[model samples]
Target: MDLIIRKYGGTSVGSIEKIKKIAQKTKDDINNNKKILIVVSAMGNSTDELLEKANQISKSPNQRELDLLMSSGEIISSTLLSMALQEIGVQSKSLTGFQAGIDTNTIYGQAEIQSINNDRIINEIKKGNTLVIAGFQGFNENLEITTLGRGGSDTTAVAIAASLKASVCEIYTDVKGIYTADPRIVKNAKKLDFLAYEDMLELANFGAKMHPRSIELGMYYKIPLIIKSSNDQEDGTLVCNSKDIKNLINKGIIMNNITENRNRVSGVTSEGNISKITLKNIPDKPGIAAKVFEPLSVSGINVDVIVQNISNKNKTDLTFTIDDKDFDKTIKTLEKESLKIKYESIMSGKDYGKISIIGSGIQNAPGYAAKFFDTLSKINVNIEMITTSDIRITCLIKNDDLDKALIKVHEVFELDK
Candidate 1:
């Protein structure tokens, strides 16, 4: 029998009735002679509510206690789902990530999975029982409960699929699947039947809710996934292990999620609430840049969009993107480098938005950039910044004009049609 791994998001198992529907689905799979493993997120918004409650009690809650508290949401859902399955006369067992042996690092909020043992899961499957797993949370080396941060359930499902070598991992969400653009933004946006890992990664990074880290796990394990709406039978998009799909001409219409009035060179995406650290003068020496960023690297603060301007009179300006979440840590790390480099100033603003338009055709079309800018110029939109890659173009625009910018740029490329 083929092994099947299915994951239901919070909305999918939000209530007892919904849990019953899930249990029935699992029973259907079992009756069809498939070995089943189901991973489920907490009931709708339960985790968020829990966090809100925690924040109510404490301005800064202890990470370990918060992890333990947050994990209970999923644990409750898993057990409820299991009970629901039993009520339907289907044999099933509920498992937490720890019980399932998903060993992870000690990071309390955003722990990374080190490995997953499948012995217990495999045995349950052999016994003709469907296994229900609490997703998103795992246990650390200290055996303390820890969570894998936002979209962690998606990551959990993929990680479990990898461990068990399941045929395919199914992601049941509110939407049918990946669309040409977010359906909310583009009503006529078509649903994509398939996508490559890289495109999905880009889409996820650009506000697609499917989550980039889960896609990363799927790619690493070469696992195929179906992103479908939990409420329907519509055949959702299948993300597969095929480079062939990425090669198809105009395989998908990727939307640039930015708004501006005037057309510029290309699309732009910028994260405001981002900081820029300029290490000036650094003796105009080699290894200086490396020395400045090495501490940041160790602290795991991801630096994005690095730019080094030409040194005027043997002085340079360095700018990189680190969001508000890491802003405090980034400043702390830079303090250590203060002795080595005398910089002008550390600056940040929460006044910008990152906008990007992604497609594979840009590299071959020499005039695409000019056309993009001309369109913006015609509309009187002023661009703040711009960046490009072989297949994509991005820009920074005023957050207020983001919607107008996206629609106009989308229209310029005839992306909507």
Candidate 2:
């Protein structure tokens, strides 16, 4: 019998009726002789509500306690859904992340799953019961409760599917499936029937709703996934191995990231939290480049888009970007080395956006960069920071102009009709 892992997001089990609907789906799968494992998220904004409640109680909730509190939402949903399954004559059980043997690192608010020992789950499934597992939260080496960050539930589902070697992991969400563009933003945007894990990563990284990190986990284990709607029976996008995408090109989607109205490039993506610090008045020598960033490097700040230019007779401007989440701590750590590097000043902003145009055919075309910039030029969107890989070109732009810029570039690139 093939093991089928179905992961339902919050909206899928938000009410008794919705749970009943899911039970019907489960019964169909069971009748087909498919052993089942179900993963579930907190119901209908429960996690968000829990976060809001935590904020109301404390300005800075302890990370460990926060994980403990937030995990309950998923527990609630899993148990309720399990109850619904039994009400319909299906044998079912709900297990917490720990009970299901999800072992992770010690990180309280952002733990990564280290391993999954599925002994207990296997025993239960062998006894003719469908197992419903809670998502997002996990247990550490010392058995401490931990939580995975935003969209971690998706990661949880993929991880379980991989561990059990399930035929496919089904992710039920609010939409029919992954679209070329957000349907709400672009009415004509079409859904992708299939997508490569790498392409899905680019789409998710470039602002698509699907979680990129979960896609990464799926790729690691060569697990196939179907992203479908919880409210209906519409087929969802399938994410699978490279072999599954062998004969495909032009995968029915294009994205354009434009920041400002200057028009240097199209589909530029930028994150504003990255502060660029230029250490000035340093000796204009080759090795001098290493002096400024040494402290940030030691502090483990991953810098992006580094640029150095000779400013005068004996000095140069050094600029780079780091994640905004770590911006404050990085700056605090750098203060100690200010005198060593003789840095002039530091500038930071959280009002930037990262824009990119993602497509499989991009790497095959020559002069693609020129064509991209030309399209942006016609639209007058300004470019801030630029980065690229063989398949993607990303730029940073102002947050205020992001919407108009994205739409114009998408149209310019013929991403939508």
Candidate 3:
């Protein structure tokens, strides 16, 4: 018997009708002799609604209590979906994250998954019953409820699939699959039938809908992941290792047999809600960089796109970008540590966004970076900061110009065609 894991996002199980549709799909799978394990997120905007309710009661709610309150949404979803399945004559069982044996670190929110004891899951599957597990929330070493951050459910699904060594992990979302660009922003964006795990990871990290941690887990476990729409059966994008992709290309299975250009640009992505902070004229000493970032790390704030220039007069400026939501906390943290770090001044900028282009072998392709900047220049868009890796090149620009920049870059790569 082949075992598989499938995860549906909030919008997928947002209503009773959608849940019934999912039940029918699962029943069909069961009849096909597939042992299925399902993971579901909170229905619709229930998570957001719950958070709003918490905020209405207290300005700064306790993190531990907040996690406990937020986790209820997924419980509601998993149980309701299980009821729907039973109503349709399908034998099913609903399990919370803890009940399914998901154990994590002690962090209340944004907890890292430490391990999964699959004994309970294995026992449930052995009974010939479909197991529906709640996503996003898990238990810590102290056995307290903890919630994974945004897109945490995806991580949960991938982690479980890896633990159980399932055949495949399927992620059902609102979109058909990964695209050359966000279709909403670039109307002509084309869907990619296949993507390398590394490319997918870069895209997710740069602001695609898929979670970066989930992609990382898939890559580590060599698990094949499929991303498609929940509303319909469509050939969605397959994400796996580059070796697998190359094998398919050699067999004339992908991209119309144009393997020669396999190393070309894959996609362009943009992320808004960015804020940049620069610590000006800090002493260019060995421990200065550590001093600046360690506090932010301990405070649970993620820093991105760091750049430090050459030392001038034994002093240099350190700049980095972070999610706008963390801007205020970051400022406050730095303000409290100013006397110790001893920087000349602290400056901040908001309304900035990042645009990136990713592919497998883009670094070896000559003129790609030059061409990227040239395209932006043609549109009168100004680039603020630049970063690059072997597979990606990123530029910072004004948030107002992000849409125009995306369209121009997507066209330059001819991704729409």
Query: For model 1, what is the C-alpha lDDT against the true structure?
Result: 0.75
Best by lDDT: 3
Clashes of 1: 22
Reference-based TM-score, model 2: 0.84
Which candidate comes out best when scored by TM-score? 3
The whole-model lDDT of each prediction reads 0.75, 0.74, 0.90
Full candidate order by lDDT, most accurate first: 3, 1, 2
Q: In candidate 3, which residue ranges exceed 4 Å CA deviation?
A: 242-263
> In candidate 1, what are the lDDT values of residues 1-417, reduced to their tens digit?
557688999999999999999889878867867677899999999999999999999988999999999999999999999999999899889999999999899988888989998898888878877889999988987889989988899999999999888777889988998766556655656566666676666667666767788999998888877788989887677676554334222322111221211222222222335444555544556887887788898887877667677778877877676666787788888887787766766655544556576655467768887776776677777776666777666666566666666666666665444
**Predicted candidate 2: what Cα RMSD to the true structure?**
6.2
TM-scores of all models? 0.85, 0.84, 0.96
The parts of candidate 1 lying over 4 Å away from their true place are 243-284, 294-300, 325-337
User: Candidate 1, after superposition: displacement of residue 153 in Å?
Assistant: 1.1
What is the model-wide C-alpha lDDT for candidate 2? 0.74
User: Candidate 3's residue-wise lDDT over 17-107, tens digit each?
Assistant: 9999999999997886767899999999999999999999999999999999999999999999999999989989999999999999998
